[model samples]
Target: MSKLLVNEKEIVVPGETLATGMDNLPGNGTYRDGENIIASRLGLVQLEGRAIKLIPLAGRYIPKTGDTIICKVIDVSINGWRLDTNSPYSAMMSLKDATFDFIARGADLTQYYDLGDYAVGKIINVTSQKLVDVTMKGPGLRKLKGGRVVEVASNKVPRIIGKAGSMVSMIKDATGCNITVGQNGLVWIEGTPENEFLAIQTIRKIENESHLSGLTDKIKAYLEKAKKK
Candidate 1:
């Protein structure tokens, strides 16, 4: 039948040989070089011992029950505020959804959350219609300011932040840029524009090559080279 190829992570290279052939193929990430296939992402690998290929045990994002996320305030109405969830679906934060305190009538609520403000919010509810409701009444939830926001694919966010904030902390240490990564793929970088730019570029590089192994060391070397340049 077919053979499998070994790679550090699952990747879509330019070709498939007879030893790597599959009669019917799955989408991206799953590849066959004959019957021997490999995983493309950093997660548990699932294999089907035939013409099929490997599947990642984990997916990038599937809205869950209690995911804390960082989001931007886009618009506000008498009823609630609109939030950019960084995905195709947007989120809502009703005035009533926030704190339990009584709000003044016709008060400048924008003072609480102006457009372009970022906040660490939580998913209070997700409807069957994909309507997401969020709240900022929890710990570590507040507005963001004076930073540059960047968008990346949802799948790359984990790589940018790394395990337990290790990757982001390292980048901040190297570039002297403060970073806040949102679960929905929104990143805020604050510092001198030069440092911010460098940090963003570095994070992007990490994201693009995250499927490869030993990425932490590679990123360290890249920062060093960039500094030398």
Candidate 2:
């Protein structure tokens, strides 16, 4: 017989039994312990058919190929720009990958991106040595201006994005801020100062209470209350 010991979206601690019997398959954030499936980390339980996974409550970012992320330009070199990827490893974007225009040697690269500039980029590849290469030549990828960037636990990104972006969409509708969530956990918000602060508060709230069920509704209520203040 198969049994679930915890409810979906419940916060579970390490070694807690999630499910039992062969019909229940363990997924990310979970492991099998004898006949029982156990939580491997503190996270929220997610059920999909007979398979179960957990969304981690918190963790640092790990760079991966094809992930869209927000990066800050740290330095510009002769061939490329070094960016702070919000990971231990920095990423480089060559001039060729930055734009379609052929930039001449000795052309002022700062004209395109200078130190302290933020950009939306995609990880093109990650080497065995942990070298990360990124690109900016794609739809909706560009330099970010006149906004503040905030970060959450990288593992919590999926929850912030929600199922098919429902959560982010809700934040946008409630706050009226143009928000961009990076896979690396960095978030950029652009709007009036008040709206930007509201968006930041909303995102931080989601990060803290992500493991709770009815999180979307909770955030909605929080945002509504902010409107009265």
Candidate 3:
């Protein structure tokens, strides 16, 4: 008889059996072994009819074209800048794509984006060899000022942002902080010291409990209780 060994939203480890018969289909993060479905990685179970997939619980971000990411300026050159993309591969932003203004030749780029500064940029291209190119010429893409950056598992980002951005929006409303979530797992929060601290705490809570069901309601309750303290 076909039977599922795991429930939806259940946290499962790699190599665990998810189903016992061919009636169940393997999806992403899972594979088929004979008639059984097995998990290929540690993740949360997601069922779509007879197909079973997994949402990764933890992993490093891999750069992809069109992803908006928060990066730090690490090296400023005569024509471009090198940015740390919170991944194994770094990204480059040329002067032509750095800003809307026409910059003069040999101009000091540091005056615009100096070392150690953070910016929100969009990945424009990624080469087969992993060379990444990013652009700052877009709405809400600019240097970040006076904010705290927190790192979480990239896979938990959807839960942190919630369905249609409800989760992060709630944290912003409850704490009065401006929050920007980077698809690369970097989150920037700007507010008063107290509010920023609260936002950080709340985001950490979401990352830790992303595998659990009823997460949205739990986060809402957590924020309400924190406000009372």
Candidate 4:
């Protein structure tokens, strides 16, 4: 018979036994160890149809191609802009990738993206050397204005997003905030001062309590209270 060694949604540490027996399979964040499934990192346990996985509690963002991310403009160059991608490696958005508009060779580059600007962009490529090339030509990729940004554990981004985007949608509805969640953990919140704080608090709560069950209801209830206040 299949035996569960831990409760669903339980927070587990590295090397903790998650289950026993051969009836279950190890998925992400877990590994099989002599008839038992063990956690490979500190994360929340997720059990699904004989498959066990983990949602990591803390980790940095590893740049991946095709990931939509928030970036900060750090420097401008004759050819492109250097961006801080919240990762160990920096990213570049070449003039061709910056926009469709024709930019003369001698044109001022800062006119396109000034220093200290925030933008929503997509990762077009990541080289073996960990060099990241990003683009702003796609839809919804542009300089973000008038919003505050916050960072969270990058690996926890999936949890903050929740299933089918239910978690983020709930937060938006609750605080009436325009929130853009980057897969890299840079979140932009634009709304009234009151709503921005509410969104920030709610996101931090999710980041802290992601391993708990019934988190959707908890966030919803918290937002309801914030609305009433």
Candidate 5:
């Protein structure tokens, strides 16, 4: 006989038994050991039919190819620029990939992307050694100006974005702020200081309560109340 040892959405730690017997299958962040299925990491439990998986609760961003992320320009070189990708590894954006227009050699790269500037970029390559390459020539990829950037748990980004972008769109409509959420966990908010503050507060609330049920309804109610104040 097979049995599920834990309830759905429960927070579990490493080595905990999630289910017993071969009837239950292990999923991501879980492994089968003998007759028992065990949690392989600290995360929230998810039950999809008979497959059990885990949603990470905390961790640093790990860059992957083809991810759209928010990056801060850290160093400008003659041929390219280096960006902090909100991860342990930084990314490189070459001149050829930075823009469609030609950039004259040794022509003061700072004129384009000066240090301390943030931009929306796309990761094009990631090496086995964790070297990352980014590009800024795509649509919606551009420098962000006059706004504050905030960080949250990268794992919770889906919840922050919500289903079909409904959560983020709601916040934008309520606070009247333009918000961009990077898959690497960096968010850029541009608007009046008051509205920006409210947006940040709402995002933090989502990150904190993402594992809870009825999160969408709760967030909608919270935003409505905040707008009244």
Candidate 6:
């Protein structure tokens, strides 16, 4: 006899009578009243077969046990390459983990990945202390080249990426740019001079106006105007 309503993607609220039944649950911005559930943020709605649930759109970038990310090789040693994960904590890529074979101890490890080389890889593990271990033995996870890196607020990343990459894809498709979003809020965009500028503008808009509701619609409108211009 209990009733639950889904207002947005990140939370679920109960109706008037149901609130009394759901008093124990925490508030995640999605709340319920007698009439309907209210959405606290903009996100995709998830239907749980028999129920409605909301998944938050914004969150901190906690390096998980198997998250794939783009990183920069900053240092090298007999052990491996030191990486900057866009977080306070850095990670290591053992030489054995670099690639197959015969890598001389130190004939200039830079030859292998050099300082400032960008690589996409997976987080093999993370210690409770936040020590991150990463590897590159996967598809489409390797060094990146010829692009400029930009950072956006971590909380705004989902809006910037959109559902199923539709938002990002539109920017890429219209501007003719190649872009990649790192979970750490780092975005890489490379393309013709004109396209790069357009992509940058789009991402900046997403960051600045993240608080506004109906962002997807706004973005579509913006892109349409741009197309006409």
- Cα lDDT computed for each candidate against the true fold: 0.72, 0.91, 0.93, 0.91, 0.93, 0.72
Q: Of the candidates numbered 5 and 6, which has the greater lDDT value?
A: 5
Off by over 4 Å in 4: 1-54
**2 or 3, greater by TM-score:** 3
Over 4 Å off, model 3: 1-27, 30-39, 47-52
Write one digit per residue (lDDT tens) for candidate 6, span 100-180.
657774566777788899877788989999988888777767778897888887667777888898889988888888888
Model 2, residue 192: C-alpha shift (Å): 0.8
Candidate 5 TM-score, C-alpha based? 0.89
Best by TM-score: 5
Candidate 2 TM-score, C-alpha based: 0.81
lDDT of 5 at 131: 92
lDDT of 2 by residue, 1-229 (tens): 8888989889999989999888999999999988999999988899988889998776678799999999999999999899999999999999899988889889999999999999999999999998999999899899999889998889878879998999999989988899999999899999889999989888888888876889988888898899888
The superposed Cα distance between candidate 5 and the true structure at residue 226, in angstroms, equals 2.3
The lowest-lDDT stretch of 10 consecutive residues in candidate 1 is: 10-19
User: Candidate 6 regions off by >4 Å?
Assistant: 1-60, 100-107, 211-213
TM-score of each: 0.71, 0.81, 0.85, 0.81, 0.89, 0.72
Error of 5 at 66 (Å): 2.3
Question: If both were scored by lDDT, which would come out higher, candidate 4 or candidate 6?
Answer: 4
Candidate 3 lDDT over residue span 1-229, tens digit each = 9999999989899999999987988999999999889999988899998899998877789999999999999999888999999999999999999998889988899988999999999999999999999999999899999988999889889889999999999999999999999999999999999999999999999988876889989989999998899
Instruction: Give the C-alpha lDDT of model 6.
Output: 0.72
* Cα error of candidate 4 at position 195, Å: 1.2
Candidate 4 or 5, higher lDDT?
A: 5
Residue pairs whose backbone atoms clash in candidate 2: none
Report the lDDT of model 6 for residue 70: 74
